[model samples]
Target: MTEPVKLYVYDLSNGMARQMSRQLTGRQIDGIWHTSVVVFGRETFYGQGISTTLPGRSHHGAPLQVIDLGETAIDEETFNEYVMEMKDHYTADKYHLLEFNCNSFTNDVIGFLTGGSIPDYIKDLPTDFLSTPFGAALRPTIDAMYRRPSPSEPTPPIPSPIPAANATPDSQLAASILQAVAAHTQASNSTPNAATQTLYAPIHAITNPPSFHSFLKSHRAAVAFFTAANCGPCRMIEPVFERLSEEKGVKADGTGAGFAKIDIGVGLGNSLASEWGIRATPTFIFFLDGKKLDEMKGADANELRSQVDLLLFQAYPPHPHTSLSLPAVQALSLNPILFTQVPAIDTVLTRLSSFIDSNPWLSTTQSPGQAKQTLTGTVAPYLKARFSAAPSSKLPSATPTLLTSWSQATSAIASALPVASLFPLVDLWRLALLDPSVGTWVSSFPTSSPILLFIDKATAALKIPDPTSNPRNYLLTVLRLLSNTFATPALARSLFLTTRAALAEVVIPSLLHTDGAVRTAAASLAFNVAAFLQKGRVDKVKGGGGHAARDNTLEDEDWEVEMVSAVVEALGRETTSEEVVHRLAASLAFLLRLSPAYDTQLSPLLDVLQTRAVLKRKLTKGGCGEDGVVKKDVRKLVEEVANKLCP
Candidate 1:
C-alpha cells in the first residue's frame, strides 16, 4: 500500500501564537512559527530532525496541525536515500531563519519522497512576511536574533509570547527582537572538505553535446576539452583526457555523473567552437556553476590534469566511500527454480479440456481459454523443439534470425490464441534450460544472441496485472529460470547490460502486487537478477585499479531507486508467505552487497533497531506446522542479515 505523509505545523507558543505574531509583525496573523513534516514510510514515521514531541525537547509543545499530504509513491528505502541526498545540501549550517530554513529543508525532503511540495499557503507565508513594510522595518532585529550559529547548525527561533517560559536565551533574544521590531520603524540585521572526497570520472569522448546550455547548467562545474584532429599533444593526452572523463563525468561510486567532451574540429563544433574563439588543439574551457571559471591553451598533461582536477572537485565534491565490493558475489546461485513446483500438465489439462477443447479452431472463438487450447497442439511442439535436446536437422536459424522467427511465431499465435496459450511453453523452456548441455550450447550460439529477444517477448507476455487469472505465473517462473543462465560470465554481462531493464520492468513493480504469489515471484526475480548484476562486475578497468563495470549502470536512476524502495516497503508489511518475506530479505541483502551506495551511511534500508525488533517478535511468536517453522527460521535469518547489512 502507498504510505502516507503528514505536514506538521508548529505554533511553538502554545495558545499565544496570535499574540506573538502581533507582537512580532505589529499585525494580526495566523499561527506561524516553525513547521516540520513527518513521513510515514512503509514501516515507521520519520521527522526532519527532532520535534516538540520528542522527549526532553517539548519546549515547543504539540504541533498546531498534522495535515495529511496523501500517500507517497516512493517506499521507505527510496525516501531514506533521498533524505540522505538532502542531508548533503541541507546541512544545519546551510539554514537561514528567513532565506533557507527548516521550511526549505522540509520542502526538499518531501519533494524527493513524493513529487509534491509543502502547501502553497505555508510556502507563501515567508514570502508574504518578507514583502510587508512592517516586516522590512523589523528585518534587522529579526535577522540578528534568529541568525544560525553556523551553516550546518540551525538555531531557528521558537516563537513564544513569553521568552522566559522556554528558559532558553536564544529563544528569549529572538522573541524580544521580534517584539521590538514590530513596535519600531527600524532596520534588521542579516544572517566537503577536500581530500577525504572522491571524484567521479569525466566524459572523454570526442563528440558534440546535445544542448550545451543545459549540459553545463546541470553540473556545478563542467570542462569542455576541445581538441583538434591533427594535434600531437592532443594525441599524447588522449588517454589522460578519457581518464579524466571517467573520474569527473561519472560518479565516485559509479552510479552516474554529469560532464561532457566536445571537439571544435567537427561539423557542429565548427560554429560553436568558433563562437567560443577556440582555434587551438587541446584547449580546455572550465566552467563552474554555468559560468567560465578559466580556460587553458597549450597546457601540458600536468597543467590540463590539474585544471580539470580542480573543475571536477567543484562539479562533484568527493565522498570518501560511495562504493563497496563483495568478492563472493559471483558465487551466489540463482536457484531453487520455481518450475519445480509446476503442477502436472495432464491433470490440469483434463480439468480445462472443456473450456479449451470446446472451440477446435480459434478463428471462430471469442474465448481466450478456447483459443489457447487450439494453439496448444501447434505452438507447444514448436517451443518444445526450441528448448529440447534433440536436433530438428533443419539447420537452426542464427540468434537474430531465431528472434525474428520467434517474434513472428508468437505474434501469429497471440493473434489467434489467448496469450496464456503460450505461457506453458515456459515450463518446457525451463526444464530444457536446466540441462548443462542445453544451457551451455545456447550461451555459445552464433552472433547476436536470441535470448535477449526472447526475454523481451517473455516479459511482454506477463505484462498482465492478474497473475492468478491465467498461466502468467508460469511465465514469471520462466523468467526466474532464465536468470540462472546468466551465471556464465559472458552471458551475465551481456544480459545485465542489455536485458536487465526489460526484466526489471517486469519484476520490481510486482513486488508490491496485491497477490501474495505475484509478490513472491517478483521478489525472487529481483533476488536472482540482482545476484546476476553482482556477478557481472569485473575487477579492473582500462584505468588503474578502478572498476568500470558499473559505469553505464541504470541502478541509480530515479525509476530504479523508486523500484527498490517499493520492494523494501513491501518487506516491512505483515506478509502471508514465508518465501516472499525470505526472498525480499535476500533481495535487500543482494542490493546492499551490490553497492556501497546502498550503505547505511547514506541511506539505511530500514530503521535497523525497529526492523530487528519486529523480526524478533515474530521469531518468539513461534511456528506450529512445517510452513510456520520455516517462517520462524526465515524470520531469524533475515534479522541477522539485516543487522549486518544495515550497519
Candidate 2:
C-alpha cells in the first residue's frame, strides 16, 4: 500500500510580512514560507531539530495552503527509519532560517517519497528575501546569530516520536541518536582536515566494535578493509576498493555483497583492529556466513578482487536458471503503462457546457439537475486549473468533497446522456483518477460504482451489431480509461478479485479488437494485470528466505488460465502490429514465469492450445508497419517465449 504525500505550506511571519513587505524591504514579498511534509499520518518539519506532530497540530497552527505532491509506495516503518538517520544532520543548533530551514528539510523528505522536489516558490524564498537591499544589510547579523561552534563539541539531535507497542523504546531511540552524534563528532575530530569532494563509494564505514560485529552478523558474506591515516599504501588502494564497492556491493534486493572499511586512527577502529589481531596498517579480511574465511595483509587490487569473487561464490551458489539464454524476455520492463496526456481543458469544459445546456431532463430533474450544477460549477473550474497548469507546478488538493461530488455527478450525468456522448466525461474522470485522493476513493467502491457503471454501459454498447466489428469511440475511450486506473495500486488489486469477471468480460473481447488503437489499449491493460501479479510473486520470493525459491504466484488460477488463453488466441490472430504481439508475448511470460503449477496448469494448457506453433508462425509471418521489415526485436522476444514454453 502507498500513502498520499502532501506539502503543508505555512507562512512563518503569518500575515505580517504580506502586509508590511513593501514598507520593510522596499519591494513586494509574500509571507516567509515554511513547508512540512505530511505522510504516513505524521507531519514532519525542522525547527527544534526535525520535529514531528500530528498533521496541522504544530505550533505554527494551520497551513496557508496544502499542495498535493502525489503518493509514495514507502510504508510507515521504512519512512521512520529514514527519519532516524536524518536526526544526525538536522540537530537543534544546526537550524538557520536562511541557510537550512523548514523548506530544506521538506525538500529532502519530498524527494525521498515522490522523487520530486518542493516547489520553487518555497525553496527559493530565502534567496528572494535576501536579494532585497534592506534584507541584504542584515545578512551578517543573521550569520552571527547562527555561527558554527568548534568541530569537537556537537549537539545531539532531538529524539524521534515515541512509537507504539513493539517499536523501539523512547530511551533506546534517544541513546541511538546520542551514540550516532558522538561517533560523528569523534570521527570528525580524528580525521586530518581535507577538502570535501563527492565520491561514489557505497562502502560502510565501521567506527565502533559493536556496529562492526552487527554488520558481519547481518550479511551472508562481507569484506572489511583495515587501514590507518598514515599508511600511504592504504590511501593509494582506497580508490580501487571504492570502485569495487560501487560496482558489486549494493543491490536493491539486499543480495549484493557487503563492503566495509575501518580507519584504525579514529574512535574504536583501533579496538576492532586489535580484536581481529591485525597489526598491519592495510589489511583485508573476507567473511562468509559471518565467519572469517580468508585473510590478506596487503592491498593487492587483483588479489582482493579475486578473493571477493571467491567469497561470493562460496556464499551464494548460482541457480541453474542463470544459464538460460533469454535476454529478450528478461529485458522487458514490468512497469504498468499509464495514459497521462492532458486533453484541452477548455475544449472538455465547452463540450460539458453544451451537453448541460442542450439536455432538458438534466436541468428539469432534482438529483440530475444538482449533479449537473456540481459538474459545471465545481468540477469544470477544478479541471481547468489542474489540467492547465505546468506538470511540475503544485496542484490544488483534491478534497473528499470534490471527489464525492465528481462520483455522483459523473454517474448521474451518464444516466441522462447517451452512451456515445459519455466519452468526454470518462476522459475527464480518467484524468481525475490520477490524483491519489480521487483514486483511493473510487477504488474503495465494491462492485457498484459510477466508474464501473460507465464501463459496463460502454462495453454493453460495443456489441451493438456484431462482436467482430471495430469498437466504437465510447468503448475505445472506456478501455483507455480502464488501463489508466491501474495507475493506482489499490484499484488494480481490487479489480483482480471483486471485479475479476467484469474485467475479463471487457478485456477478452477487446484483445481481439479490430482497431489497432483499441487492441493496443487492451494489451496495455493485460500487461498491467500480469505485472501486478508478477510483483506479488517477486516480493514473496524476495521475502521467503531465499532468492532462488520457485513460488506459486497464481492468486486466481481460473482467472490466470482465462487471461492466458485469451492472450494466446490473440497472438494467433494478431498479424498487423508487431508491437502489440510483443506485448502479448511479454504478458504471457509474466503470467507463467514463476508459477509453481506451470508444468501441470500452464504448460499443458499452452501445449493443447498449440502456443509454440502460433509463435513460430509469427516469426515466419514477419513484422507489421512500413514494408514489413520483420521487427527483429519482436521476433527475438516471441522466439524466446516459445523456447521457454516448450523447454
Candidate 3:
C-alpha cells in the first residue's frame, strides 16, 4: 500500500556495505544504500548487496541492502556525481538508509548541493560535507546516532535546571563562582585545562532583569572586588588591602594580582551583582581574567592576608623573579686601637680603671649570686685586658682617684654581660658628660660610633657649661660624619648646628638637599644661626667680655645679613610645602627683628611672602581652607618684617 519501496544497494570491494548489512538487519530498514569505494593499488569494482543484522532480530530476519563500491581509481568529482545519481533516483521513497565507508570520497557532494560547504556537521561528516542533499537527510538521524545508547554502555541521567524560586542571590552567585574558579586554578596542572577554558567564557549575572556581563582584562595580575558604597567592612580593610597589594608589587591597575574596587550599588553595579549572585555585603571576588578564581566574606585582616598570599603563590610560585630579600644596613669601617705588649691582665685592668675613673657610672661593686656571678664571669676578663696598662707613673692623689674610678668602671663594663654591660657604659657616659668634675673623660672617647657622635654633638650644641671643656672638636667630627653618612637628611639636619664650624659646613649642604624635611630643617637652622649672631652682637654692645665678642661684632652682623639673604634665596628656589613656607616666613621675620641693620634685604623676603599669598588665593579657589592659615601666617610675617625695617 505504501508503494512497496524499491531497494537499491551499492558497495565497494573488501565488503564494507556487506559488513554494514550484517549490522542493520530486521528493524524495518527498507531503503537504497550507497557505500564508499575502498582503494588499494589500482583495482576497481562496482556495488554489491550483503545481509543485514538489525537490533532484536535473528540472522534469518528480512535483510536490509548494503553496497560496497570497491577499490576505485575514480576522481573525487566522478565519485561525488555517482553518489548524487543514487540520491536523485531514490528521492520519492524518502529513503531511510545508512551510508558506510564513505571516507575516500571528498565532501564535494555537499558543495554541489548547497553551492558551498556547510558550516557544521549534522552527523559524523565534516562540516563542509553536511550541506549535501544526503547530508540534510542524515542530520537528525546523525544527531540521534550520537545520543543512541550503545549496546555495551549504560545511559546517564540528565540534570535539571535550577529553579527560579531557589535561585542564588547575585552576590552569592558571584562569590561562589569566584571560589570555584579559584579552586580550579589552584588545582589545575594542564595548560588548556579546566581553569583556562572557564576563563574564556563570559560571566553572567544570576538575577532578574539580568545585567550586562563585565569582563576583567588586566595586563598585570589583579584581584577585583565588586562592592556596595556603604560597605563598612570594605572601608575598614581598604588601607590594609592597599598595603598588601603594594607589598606584593601588584600595580593599582590590576597588574600582578592587584586590587580594584567596583561599586555595585549603581545601575550596572546592581545588575552585575545580581548576575554574580552576591548574597552578602562586603563579599570579595577574586579573578584571573573574565573567570572568577575565588571569593571571601567578612572582614578579618589576618584571614584576608593569608588568603591573598595563598592565591598569589598558587598563580605565581616563588621562583627567582618573585623572590625578595630584606634590606641590610650598610657597614662602616672602625679604627683599631693600639695595644702595648700582649697587654698583661693588670695593665689592661689599669687602663680600664683609668677609663672608669674618667667615667664613674661603670662601678665594680656587685651583689654575689647567680646574676652577679654570670655578669662578672662574662665581663671580668675583658675588663682586665682593656685596662691592663698603667699611665707609666701616676701624677697626684687626686689623679689616682680619677684614674682608679676610670679603671674600675671600664673593668665593670668590659666584664659585664649583654644589656647589663651596655646599659652601665651608656649611663656612665651620660653621667660623666653631665658632671662638671670629671667631664674631661668624654674627650678621650672616639666619635666614630654614630650613637656616641649624636650624643657628643647634641651636648655641644646645647652648650652645657665648660668644666666639660669645649665640645668644638666633637661637633666638627660629627659634622663630617653627617655630611658623609647615609643617614637621612632629617637626621643630618637635626645635628647641623653643633658649633660655628659645624654650622658653616652643614647649613649650605642641608639647604641644597633634595628632601623636603632637610630643606625645612636647614631653614630653621638658618634662623637659629641668625638669632645666635644677633644675641652675640647685643651681648657685645652691652659689654660682655670675651675675645670672640671684642674681635667680630660687625663680622657677626654681616654673617646674619648673609644668612638671611640665603634663606630668602632658598624660599624662591625650593619647592616647599605651604606649611614649610609659613615656617620659613616666620623665621625670616625673626631674623629681621634680630638684625635690623640689614633692612634693605627685607624686600626679597616680602616678595616671597607675596608669592605665598598668591598660592593661598589659588588654593582657596580650589576650596582648600587649611592652606589659608599658612598663607595668612606668611602675610603677617611679611607685614611685621616691613614694619620693623621701616620703623
Candidate 4:
C-alpha cells in the first residue's frame, strides 16, 4: 500500500547509528535498506539480511569509484562535484551519504542538492551528542560544522566564541527562567473575592487535609486558626474568634468557609503546624487562592479589634460618609507639681544640707525621683523663684554670704547625719557639680572636715579586711571617678600633684592606723596614684629650666624602684617594726607585679635585694626555711613580673 518511509540518515557515527537503529526497531519497523558510496562509478546495493560492517558489504548497493584527492583528502569543491554527478544519475532523495568527520563541506552538498532545506527523512541529531564524554572531546569541531554558513555566501562571521563546557550560565538567564515560571503559575490561579467571605481559608489545614484539592475548589478564601487545647491563651481567644466570625456574618458551626481550627493537642500530630511555621498558640493565618496573605499571633483585645477592623476594611471598602476625619492630640496636660518653679539657690542649698544632716545615707546614695519630690515638692516655690531670678552680677558679691549659710547648714546636717539623709546629700552634690556657680562654691570651701573626711571614711569602709563587710560596689564607683579624672590630661596632672603630695604627707604616715580598712585604703589610693603617674599624665618637678629633667621618666617607674629599695632597706635595718616591714614588703611586691614597666625597673630592685644580706639571712632563720610565706610571696611576685616583662 504505502511505500515504507525512506528515512535519509546521514553523518551518524557507528555508535549513534546503532542506537538510532535500535530505537527505530522498537517502533516496529518493517525493513531497512542501506546504501554506501565507494566511488562515483559501478553501483552496489544491499538486502535487509546482509552484513554491512564488512568493507565489500558496506557499499553493497552503492557505486564503486576511485576518487581520491590526496592524503589530506576530499575538499568541499571535490565533494560537491561528486554529489552533483551522483544526483544527475540517480534519484538523490533515495540515496544518502554517510560521511565521517563531515564539516561545512557536507552541509554544502546537502544544501546544494535539497535547495537549502533539510530533507524530511533527515532528523536532527540528539542534543546530548556533544555532551557525552567521547563527544565532548570533539564538540568544538562538531559545533563549528553545524554553525557553518552555505558555501555560496562568505562564511557568516563567526560570532563571539562560546565559553568551554565547564563555564556556568549567566546569572540573569537563570533568574529570568525562574521569574517566567512564577508568572506562569500565578496567571493560572483564580483570584479570591474578599467581599462576601466570612473567614479566610486555613493555610495549614488546606495544605495538609486529605481532601485539600476539593476544599480549595469550594472555598476561595478562609481564615486558619492554629491553636492547642492545652494552651490557656488559646482557650481565652476562643470567644474572640467566635465574635469575629459572627460580626462577619459567618456560620459558627464550621459549615461554610469560615473559622477553621487546627487542634494541636497531645495526641494529634503537628506536621501541618510546623509546615506553616506556627511557633505559638492562637496564631491566625489569612489565605487567598491557596496562598498565605497575612498572619497574627497572641493579640490583646484592643489590638485584635484593630486587626479585625483592618481586615474588614480590606474585605469591604467603607462608604465616603462613614470615613470621618479625627484630630490627633499632640500634648498631654501637665501636673502642677512638675510645673513648679526652681527654688531659691540658698533655700535649695539649705534644704540639701538639712536633708544630708538628718539622713547620713544621703552622703553616698542617690535616687533622682525621691530627690526631685523632696526638693521641688516640699521646698517653698516662692523662695525658689526669688533665688532663680537674682542677677548674675550680684552672685559674686553674694558668695561669702551664701558660703557662710551653706557652712552653717552643712554643720547642722552633719551633726545629725542619719542613714536616711545620704540620698539627699548625694543629689545636692550632683546639682552642685552641674551648676558652675555652686561648683565654684564647693571648690573653695575652707573646711575639709565634711568633704575630704567623708571620702576617707567611705574609702576605708570599702577596703575592710573581712570580705563580708567590704563595700566593693562603692569602691568600684570611686575607681570609676578616679579613672574619669585621668581621662583628660589637665585634670589628671592637677589631681596627681595634689593627691600625690597629700598621700605622702597624710596617708602614708597613717599606714599603721588601728583599722585594717584604713591601712588598706591608704595603700590602694597610693597604688592608683602610682598607676596614673606611670601612664605619663603628671609632669615631674623642674629645676632652673622650665622643662623638668625627669620629664621623660615615668612616675610609676621611679615610684616602684624607690618603694622596692625602701622596703629592702626597712627589712635590712632590723630596727623597723615587724608590722611596718610586713606592710612595706607586701606593698612593694604588689607594685612590682601591677606595674607595666616592672621588668625594666626590676634589675635595680634586684640589686638592692642581693646587697641586703640581712633579708636573705632572715629568710633561712624561719622553721619553714626558704619556702616560708614571706620569702614565697616576694619570690612569686618577682617571678611573675620577670615573665610578663621579659616576654
The list of candidate 2 runs beyond 4 A from truth reads 1-325, 352-368, 389-392, 445-449, 462-471, 545-554, 621-629
lDDT of 4 by residue, 211-330 (tens): 222233333445667777588887888777766654542222222233455665411216557767888888877655566767889856555555555544443322221132211100
Which residue pairs in model 2 clash with each other?
none
Q: Each model's RMSD to truth, in Å?
A: 23.0, 24.7, 29.4, 30.3
In candidate 4, which residue ranges exceed 4 Å CA deviation? 1-412, 418-450, 459-495, 501-647
Q: List lDDT for all candidates, in order.
A: 0.50, 0.70, 0.37, 0.37
Could you tell me which 10 consecutive residues in candidate 4 have the lowest summed lDDT?
328-337
How does each model score on TM-score? 0.38, 0.50, 0.23, 0.23
Residue-pair clashes per candidate = 26, 0, 62, 22
Ordering by lDDT: 2, 1, 4, 3
In model 4, the Cα lDDT at residue 521 comes to 41
Q: After best superposition, candidate 4 residue 173: deviation in angstroms? A: 99
Number of clashes found in candidate 1: 26
Candidate 3 C-alpha lDDT tens digits along 437-531 = 22232223223222343433434443545424433333332323333321222223233323344454456544555556556555555554444
